[model samples]
Target: MSSDLFYALTGASLFTLGLYALIKHAHILRKILAINVMGSGVFLLLVALAAGGQQAFDPVPHAMVITGIVVAISATALALALMLRLREASGLAVLPDTSPEELSEQLPEAPSDVASKNNGKNA
Candidate 1:
């Protein structure tokens, strides 16, 4: 019934839920959101650990949480940029859960001229 315990449990639950979503979802945006959720859970847990039953807040944990938030923001931005690049290249938002061979099979075939040009031969 204590606030710290509640926060700790909630943090754990968030982390677990995020982990499940990260594994279960194939969309890049969903995965990114899941990762952000996981980060938030960790931050919450950190804060809970720093909180010492009504004692003044520990500056270290607060500092660490701030740094983590900044890093998470940058990482999320980078992930989103990468996802956009992937979308542009593949024209899909969801990742395919297939082997490399299956992926190769799914790709469109190149034109004869393009194939020949790529083979280091004069077109």
Candidate 2:
């Protein structure tokens, strides 16, 4: 097969794999990583397609890829920071596949909750 075809297929495969991982995983970090993988696949496909054209080399796709890389890095940093905050607040990284109420019940009681309960008993 041609190199362009090979690269395109690889890009498609990567996108599919990333989609599957994004659906199958429960961890927030894993979801973030899957998103990154999907972005990479799209970037690869764009570059491959641009290179495969039968005309003068185009710089648009390359510029887009570079811009996408910068955006991806920023997005990743934001996602990781959100995950860190979630971990600190809940001590959990994986998402719950249940109702919001049930998820809330699963988390540990806060200091405020304990203090309120003690005050109620003493008062």
Candidate 3:
């Protein structure tokens, strides 16, 4: 088999695995990793397609892959930042809405005299 064929097969396999990872994993970090894997697979395919064997490798596809990699990293960084913010806001890193209403429940009723005294002080 030609080197191009081998590279193409490898790229396809990587892309397939990445797709599986994205679908099977529920964690945001895992999804991010899967997306990066998919991006690498695409970059590999671009390079393989651009390889002309004898004449010359195409510079256009190479430049495009480089730019795409930069964009992918930027997107991943933004996604991670959002994930961190979400974790901070909710106090959980998992995907489910597990926040309990009991955690935010109101305190038990205070004595009526204490309440009246507090109200009078505020007034």
Candidate 4:
């Protein structure tokens, strides 16, 4: 109907889709993307709400949105770092180790003979 209504609807849909992605995806990277999508939806909703029922633009919500965006970036960075560490340690990206057999299967192979020779030369 109205531009404001459309904005609100879009924002809501984006947020819902993000939530669904977060729930359905098993990859850590995908979860991060979903979080960013949800943050964008919130920013859109805030901007839309600020524009409504006011003649002059509101700086307060705008400032808050900027701050929120920064915080979201920080959070996403931390999440990525943690995910990387988990992947490095467990060889799995998202979910925790459930079966011992699967964990053993995911272990990295031993270095090749050429690599071993190189290491011996360096030593």
For every model in order, what is the number of clashing pairs? 0, 0, 0, 0
User: How well is each residue in 1-123 modelled by candidate 4, as lDDT tens digits?
Assistant: 668767977888899999999988878899899989999998989888788777899999999999999999999999999999876555557653346355445543532343445557678
User: Model 3 over residues 15-88: C-alpha lDDT tens digits?
Assistant: 99999988888678888999999989888887886783646767898899999999999999998998898665
Candidate 1 residues 25-87, lDDT tens each?
A: 989899999999999999998898668486677899889999999999999999999999876
Over 1-123, each residue of candidate 2 has an lDDT whose tens digit, in order, gives 668777977888899999999999999999999999999999888888878845688899899999999999999999999999887665567776876457656655743464455567678
Q: After aligning candidate 2 to the native by TM-score, how far in Å is the CA of 2 from where it should be?
A: 2.0
| Deviation in Å, model 3, residue 4 alpha carbon | 1.8
Best by lDDT: 2
| Candidate 3, position 9, lDDT | 75
Candidate 3, residue 45: CA error in Å? 0.8
Higher-ranked by TM-score: 3 or 4? 4
**Clashing pairs in model 1?**
none
What are the models' TM-scores?
Answer: 0.78, 0.78, 0.73, 0.77
Question: Which pairs in model 2 have colliding backbones?
Answer: none
Q: State how far residue 47 of model 3 sits from its true place (Å).
A: 1.1
Report the Cα lDDT for residue 13, model 4.
88
Give the winner by TM-score: 1 or 3: 1
Number of clashes found in candidate 4 = 0
| Cα misplacement distance, residue 86 of candidate 1 (Å) | 0.6
